[model samples]
Target: MDRGERFDRLRLARTERVGPVAFDQLVKRFGSAGAALEALPHLARRGGADGFSIPPEHTINAELEAGEALGARLLVLGDDGFPPQLAALDPPPPVLWTLGDPGLLSKNACAVVGARIASSAGLRFARGLAAELGQAGLTVTSGMARGIDGAAHEGALPTGTVAVLAGGIDDVYPPEHDNLWGRIREGGCIVSEQAPGVRAKAHDFPRRNRIISGLSRAVVVVEAELRSGSLITARLAAEQGREVLAVPGSPLEPRAKGTNDLIRQGAALCEGAEDVLRALAAPRTLREPDGRWDGAVPDDEVDAVRDRVLALLSPTAIPRDELARGVGAPAAVVFAALVELALAGEAELLPGGMVCRS
Candidate 1:
């Protein structure tokens, strides 16, 4: 939590090819980010990456300085200020930059997400639902997007709301939400996994959505198309063991397809705050991760297992256990090879212990 270790963690997270899963693995393997930094290059070489790079100390210093200049706080993984809900995730985010009251994240919260081009009725419903939930002492979390997402925050502003962004904490998307972004930064909270001054790409939204669900007790979907990003948030929420609720819409409405399907597949029906409340009262069902690859793999087994894991890997994601079965290696040694391959950029390390070719 001190300055030096914090700097090391930021640098490690910013390092190329190190996603959340690999980040957790490397830290657990070496015991700390500072020690992990020392071993990253050697590990990458074992995975067939010849020239891996770590961000320079000066670069991390500049990033920290930029965040400080904006009056933002950096909450790296393992920091006491990092929300316990997020830390409890299968592979928690390695870094989060916050621009307002970070305390709100630790409080009970629920996510209200939906389509950007939502119907007027849907937007109104989302706003009212958010206000009711906020009055019930739950912080409303959303992406600060237009339509349903924007409306939810407006209704919750007086109570409490947290906006998770795909870009930097200061990078306002939709260009028009400049005012909304400022209000959230001052009155509520603004959060992101990206560094300062970074603009968002299309791929970044999924990662941003992951944080929204991770920080929430449950995710409530409003109007969303069959393939909308809100559906993605609902899926991530379920995968993370958080309850999922959807506000049903008229069957004739195109936006209702996703939520209707979710309900069909067993998502709770959200008529109002009461429905969400009921789901919250139930005990959570997050499966404790078992058969973790915590210990080290001997150098002798590295090349063989790494090659086998690579051969079995394709674009199709497979659970680590299944990968282990295919490679015929102990789960520990197989995962160790995966960590290295992840760092080398040959394999992708996904949440829920799923991996595939990068």
Candidate 2:
């Protein structure tokens, strides 16, 4: 798009309650982010958000300047050189800030992730697996946390690696990774959806995991506990239609539970590079058609569905399709009302067709 439109996209992304799904709805409905920005206030007002506010233009300008100052590039959704794998996400992240060779973002990639507090064997396995994957010409992707993630990047560094961070492209947590971070900035790539200098919050890790898995053709869990971020990434990769692979670990080890459970649930067993290659070669389930209407949506249709949609929703997330069925409305109209509700800070639209109370 044009310069003005690019600025508005960043602004809308930074706006409160305008997440990936809402961003998609607004841009698709209004035709462009510039138009979306122009209509945002009225839309929120109709949804009962009288105090809705847009992030200031100067704030967006400052963020752009910060990115430029760091020599980092901003890859907006739909921009040339934006990774097609990432862009294909149902509602892709609005922007990615990158440091180092941004070329890695679009490379043939597989994720290697496990526990941050990992066993030496797990770390060694992760490093070797990453190295083999790299030598086979696939770039390895990881979250750049301690243990397995750091080992994965280390092993793959000479070939290619991409670090998807929870913090800003510049914010390196677990401070000891400063050396590794520098190596990545020089020879690999560092990327995040957060702005420059933004420290990672607890909530950001799950969001960051989606990008790690989304950028890859498949995800491999080396070792993990019953509850860990690695499994979250695995689930997201599976949901996104990427191959899910897990290393079989000794049942005696506590960290093996998650990967073992993944295997039990039918994730392919990943023993070596060949298994990964074979898994990638396997056919995947076909994605469903992205249903949409042939013509403009009516304001009255949106109004008709709003209250029923509200009554059906609670803090627990429900599928958007269920909402449509519950309200006896067309999916398009229910989605429209949902978007308006999201704008009003009344709901949250999440990945994999989920919607929940704000």
Candidate 3:
């Protein structure tokens, strides 16, 4: 992409309601970010948005400058050196703000995650497992939280590690890990999908977990309660077709309940780094890039399709294929309409290819 196109893509991403899915759809449909920007208002209006507003150019420019001032760089999707594993995620982050050595992202990686209030044995096991994985030439990845996450990064720091943050690349959470954050920048990497200086919210953690699991070849859960965020990461890993491995713990311990449940659900039982290495030996295929269409539907036909698709959608989530059938339109057309609805804030695409009214 040219410089102008790059700026346009960033501008489009920063626009209100333009998330990863909408960004991808706009780029594919309009063939360039500049063209997409030109068409956004019309599209949004057609999809029932009252008035569409494009983010001012100065806002985007200021964000870029802020990231640069922090000694961090932005990695837009499709840019050279962007991690292919992360790119394989459905609705992959449209952009990433990264600090330290971004080169660590391409290394063989495994995620070690567990409870924030981890047990002594869990912390020791996580540290040892991370050290072994790093010694075997794999970069360890994790959220820079307390307990198991901290131990895992500490152990793997000598080799390499990547911390996928829930907030901005520069916003340190928990306050106490400031030193560890600095150390990570010195020898490893810190990455975030949010714009620089944005503080994390409650919802950002689950979103961050997906990126952690998406970046790694496998995710290991050391100790977790049944409803902990560690389980969320393990579940995302499985959904992404990455290996999910959990250390079996005693059934009596609450912290072990999640890992034990994972093992019972057929996630690989991980006693040590060796178990993870063995699981990694199996061949796996990364998700392919989304297909694009060069043909364009006439404006009237697109309007009709949108109306039909909208009529079929309800507050309850429905399968995308079923909605397409109900609308009597091609799957791609229905998908494009759904993307418009999403961009207009009228619909939401849930996990498992389901959609519902927003």
Candidate 4:
């Protein structure tokens, strides 16, 4: 892509309501980001939006400048250094701000995640497992949180690790990990989907977790409570068809409950790094990429389909296939219409192929 086209893609991605899926649809439907930007207002209007505006060029420029100032660079999708594993995700981040060595993304990786207030034994196990995995030639990846995450990174730092941050690449959360964050920049990598300077929010953790799982060949749950974010990452790893490994913790420990439950449900039982390595050796089926639209729907036909799809939507999200059946439209056509609705802020595309009116 040329410089101008790259700028357009960045602008489209940062535009309100234009998420990863919407960005993909716009580019595929219009043949280029430049063309997509030109058609965005019309598409939004056709989907019942009162107004639509692309982000100003200066805003994108400022973001780029900030990343540069922080020693980070933007890795737009399709760029030379973008990780292929992450690209294989159903809807990967359109752009990622990256710091430190970009080359680490090419290596085989595993995620080690667990409770922030972990027991001493859990921390020791995580650290040893991480070091063992690192020595076994796998890059350890984790969110830069306290307890288990910190221990894992410290163990793997002598080799390599990747820290997927929930906040901006330059912003440090939890306040006390400043030294670890700096060491990660020197030894491994720091990455985020959000623009520089943005603070971490409560909702960003799940999104961050998906990227963590997406970038790895497998995810290991050291210790987690039922409601913990570590479980969320494990679930995402399963959804992404990556291997899920859980440490067998004591039944009396609260943090072990989630891992035990996962093992009971057939997640691979992890005793040490050897378990993870053995699981990685097993061949697993990978999900094929979703088929793309050929942009065959005529403008008038799209309008009709949009209306029909809208009629089936409510505050309650329904499966995309169910909406397609209700509207008597082809699934691809319904998806295209929903993309337009999503970009217009008239609908939401949830996880698991679900959709609902916004």
Candidate 5:
């Protein structure tokens, strides 16, 4: 893509109601970043708006400057060396702001995530597993939060690691990890989907967790509560057809329940790094088509479908299947509409296609 085209694509990405799915559909349908950029406002307006607003060119330029100031460049999803696993997600991040050695992402990766207030044992286990996994030539990936995530990065630092953050690459969420962030930028890498200057928010964490799992071959959940963010990453990994590994914890510990339940559901019980590597080495093909349409809904139909979907959804969580059935729309249309709603900040897409008004 040329410079103007690249900027146009970035503009599209930063536009209101334009997300990965819509972006991909636009690109695939239009056949170039240039075309997609030209088509974005038209699509948005067709979906029912007199006008559409994108991030100002000055803002995007400022973000680029900030990334450059930090010695980080923006890595678009389809760029050479972008993690294939991450790129394969239905709605992969459009661009990543990365610091340190981008080549670290080329190495095989295993994500290690858990509670921020993980148990001492869980921390130790994560550290040891990361150390061994690094020794085995695997790159560790995690959200660089406290406890398990911090330990995992520290353990893997000698070899390399990837820290996917909830904020900009230059913005460290947990203030305590400022020094740790510097270390990773020097010895490993830090990346983010949000633009520079974006502060970490609660909603950004799960989006960040998706990248943590999406970039890896497997996700290891060490100690996570039933509702922990780490378990969210584990679920995303499973849905992505990546191996799900759970390190057993004491049943009495509330944090362990998520992992234990995952094990009961057939996630591999991880005893050690060897178990993780073995699972990664196992022969498997998760690239099957699964019969899902890889196309986007026509622009003219986008808003009508979105409104129908909105009518069927409620504050109470409802299964997406039932919502689609109630709306009498194809599942793919519902999925695309949900993606649009999510981008527009009108709805939230939960795991398993469930959505609720934001």
Candidate 6:
């Protein structure tokens, strides 16, 4: 894609109410960012937008300029250097604003997520595991927060690492990690789905977690509470078919409950990097670049099927297979419809593709 096309893509992504899924569907159907930008307002209106508007051109332009001024650049999904694993996601972000060496994205990677207030043992384990993974030529990725996340990045720093920021790539949150953020920017990679000037909102953290999981072949949770963001990332990793490994923590520690629960629910138990490596050694489980888009439905047929599926959904969530049967549509068509409905903000695709009127 050319600069103008990328600019248009960014503009579409920055538009209000245009989430990742919608942006991707529009791009796939239109075959160009320019066309998608042209189509968005009409699509929104049809999908029940009272007033839809794309983000102003100058807003996007200024975002790009801000990034450039900070020595960062916007990296659209499918761009030459975007992470292959991330590109394979069902609805990858249209673009990621990045700083430092985006080249680190190409390296084999694993994610380590855990509590910001992790115990001393958990932090020690994270650092040791990260170093071992780094020694094996895997680039350890983390959120670069405090505790386990910080330890993971610091351990992998001598080799390589990647930090997926919840805020803009240029905006280092927590303030105290300023020096650590600088180190990663110089020697590793920092990425964010939001534009450069966007502040990290509460909702942005889960979105940030997905990228941390998506960029890696596997995700390791060092310590996490039941409601922790790290657990959310682990669930997303599992849904993505990426290996999820969790270090067993004592039952007494509330922070360990999430990881232990994951282990009980069939997530791999990781004592160390060797266990993770062994699990990854299985022939067909690790994601192959060639297989990323192997089974995706073709773009041409999505919209027609999407229209049919929307009519089946109601305010209550319904099982996809049941909806497919009720609507007398093929499973794939129902799947595409749910995806489109999700993109259009007419429906929500819950875990298991359960569709609900939105």
Estimated TM-score per prediction?
A: 0.98, 0.97, 0.95, 0.96, 0.87, 0.88
Give per-residue CA lDDT, model 4, range 68-113, as digits (tens). 9999978888788899888887777788999999888878999999
- lDDT by residue (249-296, candidate 5, tens digit) is 788889899999999999999999999989988876554322243455
The list of candidate 6 runs beyond 4 A from truth reads 285-322, 330-345, 348-355
lDDT of 1 by residue, 1-358 (tens): 7888888999999999988988888888788899999999999998889889999989999999999999999999999999999998878999999998999999999999999999999989999999999999999999999999999999899998999999999899889999999898888999999999999999999999999999999999998999899999999999889999998988999999999999999999999999999999999866555645666778788777888899999999999889999988888889889888888889998887799998
**Of 3 and 5, the candidate ranking higher by TM-score:** 3
Off by over 4 Å in 2: 285-289, 293-296
Q: What is the lDDT of residue 157 in candidate 4?
A: 95
For candidate 6, write residues 255-326 as lDDT tens digits: 999999999999999999998898788754533232221233654555556666777778998876688788
How high is the CA lDDT of each candidate model?
0.92, 0.90, 0.88, 0.88, 0.80, 0.81
C-alpha displacement of 272 in model 5, angstroms?
0.9
Using lDDT as the yardstick, the better of models 3 and 5 is 3
TM-score-best of 2 and 6: 2
Alpha-carbon lDDT of model 3: 0.88
Candidate 2, lDDT over the whole model: 0.90
Off by over 4 Å in 4: 292-296
